[model samples]
Target: MLKRTRKHIKQLKRSITQSLNTPGRPTLPQDELNIIERIRKAAAANNQNNITRTQAYFNFYQNHPEVHWALLAHLVSRNAGWNMTDLKGEYLPKLLTDQEQVDFFAFLERGNWLIFQDAYPQLLLYEESKKQKRPLFHLLDPLNISKFMKPFWENMWSNERKEELTIALIINEQQYIEKRVIHNTHYKNKVLDTIMFKLQDVLDFNHILIPYTTPLQQKTKLVGGTVHHFSSVEDRITLGKGLYDLLFSVQSRLTQTVKWAETNPHTGSRKDYWPDLFNDVKESTPGQVHELKSSPCSLQVKASRIYSPSLPSVWKDWEHNKAEPGDWYPNKKMFHFVKQPIKQLSGDIEKTYCETIEELEMAAFTKNTFFHKK
Candidate 1:
């Protein structure tokens, strides 16, 4: 009987230990776990509050079927020079309005992921074909163009940008295509015709080209080559000029901003640099931009006025501050304080303080005043 009891106790202990270990719980692969952790960190860095960040991560995970770690790594790579937090606080704000920032970031976070699935495979195919000296091209729309061009802008000061000759390459391709069509028609050219026929499949692709900027990089400079299609010559001209303008503007302004930020002893590493840009007001001295509004206290106060307790009442007697002390007295029918049941601790009596509307108003005003000063 004693041996049987001991055996039963051992079995119970084993079962309890197994249950505590959570044997039934599903486990994720190491790579997937790493991606999830990165996403969590990214969301936290981007959002203002913990609750918002947590909700955003859940929403992102639920919406995206799978995570592409490679694509994510590319976006956050040192070569890319993108800070995910800056997308919300700096980059997007330049491209979008205040109202559009939230939805745009959410869209960008997921949209890029979806695009990556389609893009990465094509990029791989292009890479392989390029080795055999085969022509491979891809079409670039507004979204992907920005992604492709961003890296070039990042290396603006480097010799790689000049050697890549992005604009010159596109011009060469355009001239080659036009000249070949005309030349083939001018003479009976079977070889050129056959080559063009073979390329016809991918000819319409909006091809983008990246440059080999770094030796340590695994990626190549020749990304995609293709004929760009436009509705009209005027539109094409406008877009071409626009592309050059965008590159030039970003290159000039970003170079200046970075130099200022890095060299200025007053500007700390943690300081935000975006607000200092695009002021367009040049200082009497060089390399200084005008400062915009530091804080949105005025805007906040203006917005709060609509819903504030201080707003005029529809009925004069029902105003927020019109309530009498008698109305809040014990057992009063008009208005009464419902006393919360208190638990005695160490035989001590504690005073319960009730907050008043006037006090709340004063507090809000004080907070606003403090914000305005900063």
Candidate 2:
């Protein structure tokens, strides 16, 4: 009887342990786990409030498991250069403060998991396709141009002012504006939830307000004057020059902004000689980007159809969109609602754009066709 009782107890224990083990928690690899632990430590050292950084990791790992170690390794690599001892005067107003930047570095490092979805180990790898493709400029009507260019611009700048200037100009030229139209949140905002006071300011600037809006009824209010969609194939000379002027300025100014990184010829690693992520007005004067690249007014919008098929009736709003607060800005996303391969136009300088709409169209597609926070 005693032997039989011991056997029963052992079997019962085995069954319980097996139930508990059921591939619990979908753990990352040991190396990946170690990286996450190090990131947590790094985040804490930068700030006691490493909550945001932690959550970003949690979210990434929850979904993508394949590159977890690669991502973690990628993140730890960024800690290689940051000089954290300096504070306000040391690193401020240029690259975030030592603490803020360190914290961000950690966060982004952990974000490697998401980034690893593409090029994992190299920064130079981005936009290789864009570099290979020699692109042409366009002055297609402002709204269409704005719609296409907005995401590209947003991807390249971090400052709200710079982004705003770019967006306003794009919209002004495109002659249309899109409000978030629906409420949504940025990643940081969602993690902080209601505790974030900045949420108010972000919402004011980022969210579109429409009290009557519902998922059932997608609605938006266009804040600015809407440019009529161009139907005329007649050369839109005024527009072509305007677009070229703005784009050329952006490219020139931006190039000047990032020039230091390219020319300084630093030794060591990226983090080691990271010449202040960008320069300031005081440290070095910004080169002028306002120069007209060509005979400004001579530029014309070359269209396939010289005579517009007659633009449809004008409306105050461009289109209704369903957007959320979680979406990131300084990033543009387009959803296709119209099925037609709609054609539009823009041009400038001596190039006269491409000879046919096919070339022009191809040029526009090729230009700056990459995205990320530059």
Candidate 3:
């Protein structure tokens, strides 16, 4: 028997009944436990949009007594060839209906569904069990089995169809068992947040096009279970390009005018970013040093500096200037042309991330996952 905190159990009971209408207050079934696990994975993978729909899919499985789905849940646990941890594999099935049996055998031939979306073909999206279990839901009469078959599904089962069926079976079983499942404190992090963080760990956000709280259709290159991680140079170039495009677009907005220094001068006053200046100046007063007012300010200093198409934009890869060879010269000065115009740019580019876009996620719980409660 699993234990829950008093407060959690109360909410748990309510969520169970409201969602599934389970008779009498009872503990979760094994399928419900597994559903919790699946939810954890889906959340971890940054697939929150599928969360609600999937829960609904599972509830339908449990409620529709006509569809026996107990065996389906069991199939999801098998290791077989596909990696279950990564959610990639062929799902297991049991042919209770005559049509299902026929369709199942047809898969032995070279028949499969044709997918059109631009996505990783070899990369398995989700994994399911290979060995099937017995059905929990059965019809009142034996003859009703023939009527349940869909014409399309009845034609012939392809490898893709088999995989789809496995997915369906997992969802169906959840329908009945979901309400019984308890999320508990196991929900250590927001699913969407976790997904985003993981993606960041692998690649930059600009590289991935996952919209918040939505089904993801990413075009990726996965070698084995891992994505083909781009080189650091590639990531920098991509990020720089995205920023350049955005900055340029905003510059063209023209609601506010923007102008740049006439030369390749470092003028933008970086707020709180000044280095420790080596002051070799002889001061008249120890504490009261005069603010060396040199020409007051530069006229070109503006609110924002935007990269325009006509502007000579150089990649300016960070390379230090070569050391100068010196002859016997008297008091030769080295001048640095830094455009220091205070109040030149907005007070730091305030970055904002929508809290509503965040989601709950799950993982095995690493040491870095925990933090002191603020």
RMSD of each: 32.4, 25.4, 29.5
TM-score of model 2 relative to the true fold? Answer: 0.20
| lDDT value, residue 49 of candidate 2 | 18
The residue-by-residue lDDT of candidate 1 on 228-274, one tens digit each, is 44222223323332333332333443333223323321111112222
For residue 291, model 2's alpha carbon misses the true position, in angstroms, by: 38
Off by over 4 Å in 2: 1-106, 116-191, 194-258, 264-333, 337-374
Model 1, TM vs. native: 0.21
- Put the candidates in lDDT order, highest first: 1, 2, 3
- How do all models score by TM-score? 0.21, 0.20, 0.16
Clash totals, every prediction? 5, 18, 17
Candidate 2 lDDT, 204-235, residue by residue in tens = 21111101111233321111111122211111
Using lDDT as the measure, name the better of candidate 1 and candidate 2.
1
Model 3 poorest 10 in a row by lDDT:
110-119
Question: Lowest lDDT 10-mer window, candidate 2?
Answer: 306-315
Model 3, 99-179: lDDT tens per residue?
332222222110101000000010111212212232212110111111112211221122223322222222222221211
Candidates' lDDT values, in order? 0.26, 0.25, 0.20
